[model samples]
Target: MSIVRYLTHPQVQIDPDVPVPQWGLSPIGRARTEALAQASWLARTTQVISSGERKAIETAEIIAIRLGIMIEIREAMHENDRSATGFLKPAEFEQVADQFFAEPHLSVRGWERAIDAQARIVREAEAVLARNRPGDILFVGHGGVGTLLFCHTAGCPIDRVHDQPAGGGNLFAFARDGRQVVHGWRRMEEVAA
Candidate 1:
């Protein structure tokens, strides 16, 4: 069966001065993405796409280079627009994130509504899959919307309980045709072909 993988960019360099969308991967994050490139399953990816944000793009670029492939960037694949609050410290961000998942229908501190972000991510992913019939497709993006998409594909409720673990660099797999989740979130290195 055709399979699609969605991966969240690994940890990022937290630069309060830099726009959150512009912040690239941290040194450790780059190392993590590079290490993930060695996964056997990544070699099978025929199409690679990423959110327009820097971190996601950086992560996608690393994998693409390893596989000798090109990356397609999609703005709709961006993390839920937390631009309302800009960059919050990790501690504060977690609190806001908790509320975001808890109330999917409501805007958390003027951030993009969870429901809205889910819709956008789902729509973009569907459109991408419709146009590409690759044997294996990979989407590199953020954790928030990734969890939302994962919930939609898995036929689960939009809840943070479905979210990936505390760090980034996690992934989920689904059947491209049926859109059924084949696997839950796991670190990139943990995935097998």
Candidate 2:
């Protein structure tokens, strides 16, 4: 059976003053994504969808162009809403993220609860899959919500242990029909056709 792949955008240009959603891909991120476009596995993707966030959109665009497919942006595919806290430094963000995963029910420092984000992601993903024709699909979004969705599909609990590696550019595949995760997170370049 074919698979649905969820990819997290790679490294982004960190501008402390900018809103997290507006931040785009960094130089290294662009380079890495361009390289990832060369992966043979990407040829299998017939449709590309992305979160409205700039970083994810940028990543999706790169892949879409390489695969000669148009991108469909979905607002619900966005990262866990962190607007309440704004841009926390990496160290501070990591601390809060740990809490977010540890207590899936509670909003850590005004961030969206992990369970809520998980529900939104799963719902949005299901909607996308239901409406589209059967084929390999690629969903480009953020790591936090991606992990939550992966946890759901894998029959695992919401935990950072299931999160993608730091710095992003990771993906996991799931069987399209039954929604069973075929594998854990792997770097984009590492996935085969």
Candidate 3:
């Protein structure tokens, strides 16, 4: 079965001063990504794609090196546009996320509406799927947008998006042709360290 696996780049070096897009994974993040490459499931992957973001690109690069495959950059796999609100301190950001999830479509305090991000994610991922042919297709992207996109693609209720953690550890696996989810969602945390 053809599988589309949505992977989120692991722990990033959080910098509130820079745009999130420009920030890359921390050393620990790189370690996590490398660990992912060594996972048994990854042995079957034949193709790879990544968001052009630094962290996502870094993750994809690790996978490409291990799998000996070229990494295709897809704009659709990019993180949600958080440019309107450049950066927030951790506690402050958590509060914002709490509000954002409550009314996902409406803008609250300058964050991009989750609905808009979700729509773009769905569109971009669909386009990516059109290019795949059997084996396994790996997509490396940021967390928020990846979760939103995966929910859209899987026909899951947006409210149940939390059924899968909203972190880099989450992976969404789906059958390419039938769009049937072979696996609903799995956490990297479940993989042995």
Candidate 3, residues 1-193: lDDT per residue as tens digits?
7777888887898887778898988988888788778777787788888898988899899988998889999866677676777788878877777666667778868777888878888887788777666678888886677767666766765553354565465677777888777665667656431
Write down the lDDT of every candidate, Cα atoms only.
Answer: 0.93, 0.93, 0.76
Error of 1 at 78 (Å): 0.5
The clash tally of candidate 2 reads 0
- TM-score of every model? 0.97, 0.97, 0.88
Worst 10 residues of 1 by lDDT: 127-136
lDDT per residue, candidate 2, 116-184, as tens digits?
A: 999999999999889758679999999999999999999999999999998899999999989888889
Clash pairs, model 1 backbone: none
lDDT of 3: 0.76
lDDT of candidate 3 at residue 94, scale 0 to 100: 70
Residue 181's lDDT in candidate 1: 86
TM-score of 2: 0.97
Per-residue lDDT tens digits for candidate 1, residues 94-174, read: 999999999999999999999999999999999999986757999999999999999999999999999998779999999
**Model 3 worst lDDT run, 10 consecutive residues:** 158-167
Off by over 4 Å in 2: none
Ranking by lDDT: 1, 2, 3
